[model samples]
Target: MTYIGRFAPSPSGPLHFGSLIAAFGSYFQAKSQQGQWLVRIEDLDPPREMPGASSLILNTLESYGLHWDGSVIYQSQRHQRYQEQIDSWLASGLAYYCQCTRKQIKQGGGFYLGTCRHKSQLTPEGCSVRLHVKQAIEQFTDQKHGVITIPHQLAQEDFIIKRRDGLFAYNLAVVLDDIDQGVTEVVRGADLIEPTGRQINLYRYLNQPEVSYIHLPLALDEHGNKLSKQNHAPAVDTHCAKETLIKVMLFLGFTLPDDFQSASIEQMIEWGCQHWSLQQLPNSLASSTL
Candidate 1:
């Protein structure tokens, strides 16, 4: 099958080191396989988005020579499409309106107990939409992490597709967007492994083919915390693009020549693509200090 990959990021902040690692890894992986690599701006949550973050992210990627295929899709512009999918799910009894708050769910033992599954008359204003998960994706094989399994109870929970704040949940939006973009492989950070099972089930519910997954190691700080925008990780220096690219390539387990360190960005990237090894990537990056 023709391989297609994507790097989807939320517009909550500018591109940081962790973000670059994900983008660079995905770009190299796709280029190595001669696959199409696309970029998607996950701007569904308006309240969390920073002003100009979307443009800044695109600019950063370009500065690092990570040009994406086709036009970059913005989740904000696809509200109608998401609504259409939700309506279809509701009509088919695959999903239902949920009125249970976080506190109420926690009080009932954390996982949702289907309290609102039978409540068809619940108003949609303050309600969220949840998938009525009848089947479970027990296990899936990851490209890097090998076999992964989901617990029966966790798999059976009626996960929310839309939030009470009128925003489409990440689980729902990502699955739909992947299908829409024909993403054949999802290469992202290992932090998202938990959601893999949920997304796999979503594909089955929507009658869409499942995509392959490869989760890269996450860059962490000295305290062992993942480098993230929420953790206030500094944005990557686009002015030092070549140096940054070399560092990311090394992080992905590529050994470079001494003279190549002084090579141009394009040459380094070409060498990286030619020598990219999926087996060399460590399960997790110990720290970002390296």
Candidate 2:
């Protein structure tokens, strides 16, 4: 089977150093194996999305020599596809309409206890759709981290596939998109590891082939918090793309040649593909200062 990987980013803000780490890690992991690396713009949430952030992200990737294999996919354009899957699940009795509020779930111990699983007749206007979750997957092996076990309550809970506001949930959309794209592997940040079992369960529900996973270590700020756009982590400097690329390489635990400082961006990337190794990556959170 052809090894296919992807770099998916939400268009909520500019790509930061943390974002670059995920992009490059996925890009080189695919390139190293002569696999196809695809880019997907996860523009699912309209309220949280920033104007023109998708274009800026694509431009930044291009500037850093991280060109992808095909035309970028936008989740906003795939609403029909997402809805179709939800409809199929609803029809098959695999899912149902839920009227449970966030406060209600939190008050009920933070795990949804299938309050609305029997309420399929609930009006869709004020309801979100949730999977029945008969097969709760509690464990999966990560390519980098190995043998991860999810909390039983989280794994067993009936999770929402669509929001009360009529938006597709990330877990539902991401799994369907990966299946549609024929992705063989998912290389992303470790921060997403908690959801792997949930995504895997979705794959099982759809009877689709499961993809392999490699979650790279998250980049953390000086305060030990994950570097994210919400935390005001600065966008990567495109003006110094080469330097930033070098820093990313070092963070991934690659040892460059003494003369690599003078190498062009393309050359550095070429070298990276030729030398990429999963074993070289650091398992702990990487400091953003690097």
Could you say which candidate leads in TM-score?
2
RMSD of each: 1.5, 1.3
Return the top candidate by lDDT.
2
In angstroms, give how far residue 173 of model 1 lies from its true place: 1.3
lDDT of each: 0.88, 0.91
Pairing residues by index, what is the TM-score of model 2?
0.97
Query: What is the per-residue lDDT of model 2 for residues 140-170, given as tens digits with 9 covering 90 to 100?
Result: 9888778888999999988889999999999
Model 2: lDDT of residue 6: 96
Query: Candidate 2 — which residues are off by over 4 angstroms?
Result: 284-289
Each prediction's TM-score versus the true structure: 0.96, 0.97
The Cα error of candidate 1 at residue 87, in Å, is 0.6
